[model samples]
Target: MRKIPVKYGIEILVICLTPFLFMISESISNGKVTGILFSFGYLILVGFVIFGIRYWIENEELVIQNLLFWKTRIRISEVSKIEKTWNALSSPAPSITGRVEIYYNKKSIVISPKNFEEFKNELLRINPNIIIKE
Candidate 1:
């Protein structure tokens, strides 16, 4: 079994946090009850800020887990194509760069495993038929 942590993008983080912080600050300054709700919402965001994404391999399955109660499992044998991509779309991937689109079981998902080569090698070791495009 192997576990790989996800990478993070500082720029993307800043882009996401800026407005949230601004709204919280503005609401608090206005002395509104909504400020308290905003504060709670901010805490929720902070709780998920790290994402805690882990791409772990166990037996023949690849499990993707995050801080939230979110988990995705894909069979190694089901993996069809692995292609490198840099997308801003919200996904399990916390990082914008070093993201890869994994096609599996007639479906797809994007993720960012810190060590791409190692992850790819391990995937191939389990299922040599998996196609990878650089």
Candidate 2:
């Protein structure tokens, strides 16, 4: 099992909430009902950040847990291919770091591991049939 690095969680939270902070500050300057709404929004944003951080810290098996919705894991023999590709729109924005693709049969999953090269090599060691692409 592998855990997401704490720095990645903090970076993501900061990037997402920085714009809202600016908006909230502007609303306060305007001195209107908008300020109250912005304040509430800020609280909600903070809540999300907290949840994300907790999730990152609690989760293990980086790819398996992070891409569970996609059912990434299967018996090693079932894997047909593994390749790496980049797409700003479909992939996670701002590219958290150490991103890779895990392919099994007809399905594919995206995950960001803490030590990408080591993770890939480990996977290959586990299942030599699995392919790795640059």
Candidate 3:
């Protein structure tokens, strides 16, 4: 099984900083103890969610492990197209950069694996007929 790392760049930075910002704002308005607890809880939740998101290829399928519970599997034979995209629109992609859009089942999902080329090539290997749009 090949594990593909997610490219969490500036987007992750923003996400990591948001709770702290909120914590500071809350502390100024409310109280220190409450703000810290809330911020810690938020941080733990975000960390757990991010830690859970993973992508891998196994048994001729692309597996998307999400939020520690949700798993989205796409069969290799069903893949119709693969394309590189810079779209920041929210999707399965964890990052705002180096994303790939996979088309299948009359639908598509975006993902940002660290090795974008390798990920695309692996998918192409699985489905040689898949059209790759630059």
Candidate 4:
């Protein structure tokens, strides 16, 4: 199974921290306590974002293993269909990020892979029975 690259996380960190850095710098110039607080809060938020992304990337697999939660394994044969879905209102909206929906036994699970096309192709190779819908 493929995993997200470290650069992806770094890129995300840079993107997110840019505004925070700007705010912190401006606050320093103005000498306001609010700016310092905001900077601290943003730092914590960025750390959490980094950790969450890393965890999701590392743990993303067809067969998920969890100590607290039950292990779930999706067999290739059980997959009936694969599709890419998008919606406007969803938090972490599909417009900004792409998602893969895997249909099996009348249920579906969605995962966001770094390389969506390659992920779909691998899944198709594993299960030729899987229908790829536009």
In candidate 2 the C-alpha lDDT for residue 106 amounts to 77
Listed per model in order, the count of residue pairs whose N, CA or C atoms clash below 3 Å is 0, 1, 0, 0
Alpha-carbon lDDT, every model = 0.83, 0.53, 0.83, 0.59
Cα RMSD, each candidate:
2.1, 5.2, 1.9, 5.7
lDDT of 4 by residue, 17-132 (tens): 89889989999999999998999899887665444432122222465332234445677678899877653232221123465567888877654556767766766766778898
lDDT of 1 by residue, 20-120 (tens): 77877788888877876977787677647556567899988999886557789999999999999976677788878899999998988999888889999
Candidate 3 structure, TM-score to reference: 0.88
lDDT of 2: 0.53
Candidate with maximal TM-score: 3
Better of 1 and 4 by TM-score: 1
Query: Where does the lowest 10-residue lDDT sum fall in candidate 2?
Result: 53-62
- Locate the minimum summed-lDDT window of 10 residues in model 4: 87-96
What candidate 4 gets wrong by more than 4 Å, as runs, is 4-26, 54-77, 88-97, 105-109
lDDT per residue for candidate 2 within 16-125, as digits (tens), equals 67777777777778876777697777878565434433112212222343222432235545555666555333333224554566677677655555556766665666
- Measured against the true structure, the TM-scores of the candidates, in listed sequence, are 0.85, 0.58, 0.88, 0.51
Candidates, ranked, lDDT = 1, 3, 4, 2
Candidate 2 ranges beyond 4 A from true positions? 2-15, 32-63, 66-77, 90-97
Pairs that collide in candidate 3 are none
User: By the TM-score metric, which is better: model 1 or model 2?
Assistant: 1
Error of 4 at 61 (Å): 5.0
lDDT of 3 at 73: 95
